[model samples]
Target: MEFSGNPALYRRIAIAVTLYINGGAFIIFALIKYLLHGDTWVLGWKPVLVTLLFSLWFGRAMYRWMMRLDAQYGRGSGWVLESVRVKLPELRPRQPR
Candidate 1:
């Protein structure tokens, strides 16, 4: 999971993450357009185009950010969202009925 030794793997992970973010952005943008325009087809290409460009533009920044985060958190833990990883409280077993 450590990206420091393997640059190829690091770049690949960044690409995958970029694609995922681009997809999600497109979905949200499209939904918003649908709600506002009452039709998903109208100017639909704009969202697709925008998201594509957005991904391309920010992809490098993302890679850099990931590396910084990886350095900050260390041991590849940065790839895993720390905020999303919460300690779950233990649940006691219910008494047999």
Candidate 2:
């Protein structure tokens, strides 16, 4: 079924194309690097660790940006697939028995 005026077919196609292009570029780069050096050490752990830290730090910002974009342009399914939103609230301290 169609969703929120978005044609599922077209949405799927666009997502597929976007994933293909980005994923293909990553694969190509990795393959070339592997072929040339035959080791991941050139990429190195420090840079990878920094990237992971950056991703963790900025992931929320990225998600909010995408949410705003979706709200503005009426694009994206926006957390529909997952039931949870806004993260689970922190648990409160238990009362004394």
Candidate 3:
């Protein structure tokens, strides 16, 4: 399948995948912590805060890295963009008010 060559669509897919990865990791970590220590706050709020920060950082980093790779190598199969194309609404730049 031919892609529309839309960077916006690529970006959206990258972001969505990154979020799912980070979210799943966070949930697993929370579950493990709760099971082992009987509470998610076993280490207090600092660890939770750190986990949240790390997840966000990791997700953003992954998205940027993937986007860079796609830009450099081009989409080989175009499967990723094709699968996500219909899910994402058309994006347009907003005019200044």
Candidate 4:
């Protein structure tokens, strides 16, 4: 829908989301490996290359999702962060048993 809009912004957001997800997953995976082997390991280029290729698809998916959200909420990518603020419910004290 926003084919004529700011394509750079969408690409940036999608890449950022992709990196965040992949980075977090890599950290968790490394931790798991360390726990199992009791040692840390250096980063590998093969994995990096693999992730880079995978992220292309993931980033496109993220872009599509964001576009869908933007259309559904009638807001651009910039507005989604502030416009969809969720108010927390007040936590009251529980009654005594």
Highest lDDT model number? 4
Model 1: per-residue Cα lDDT over 18-40, one tens digit each: 88888777777677878977776
Model 3 whole-model lDDT (C-alpha atoms): 0.67
lDDT-better candidate, 2 vs 3: 3
Give all candidate RMSDs, comma-separated. Answer: 9.7, 14.8, 15.7, 10.3
Query: How close to the true structure is residue 39 of candidate 4, measured as C-alpha lDDT?
Result: 53
> Which of 2 and 4 is ahead in lDDT?
4
Pairs that clash in candidate 2: none
lDDT against the true structure, per candidate, is 0.71, 0.55, 0.67, 0.72
Off by over 4 Å in 3: 1-4, 42-44, 72-97
lDDT of 4 at 37: 73
Stretches off by above 4 angstroms in model 4 are: 1-5, 39-42, 65-97
Worst 10 residues of 4 by lDDT: 72-81
Candidate with more favorable, higher lDDT: 1 or 2: 1
Candidate 2 error regions (>4 Å): 1-6, 41-97
Query: Taking the tens digit of each residue's C-alpha lDDT, what string does model 2 give over 1-97?
Result: 3334334444454455555655565557667888987968536777556545654445444444444445534354353555665877899999999
Which one wins on TM-score? Answer: 1
Q: After superposition, how far is residue 45 of candidate 2 from its true place, in Å?
A: 9.5
Q: Is candidate 2 or candidate 3 better by TM-score?
A: 3
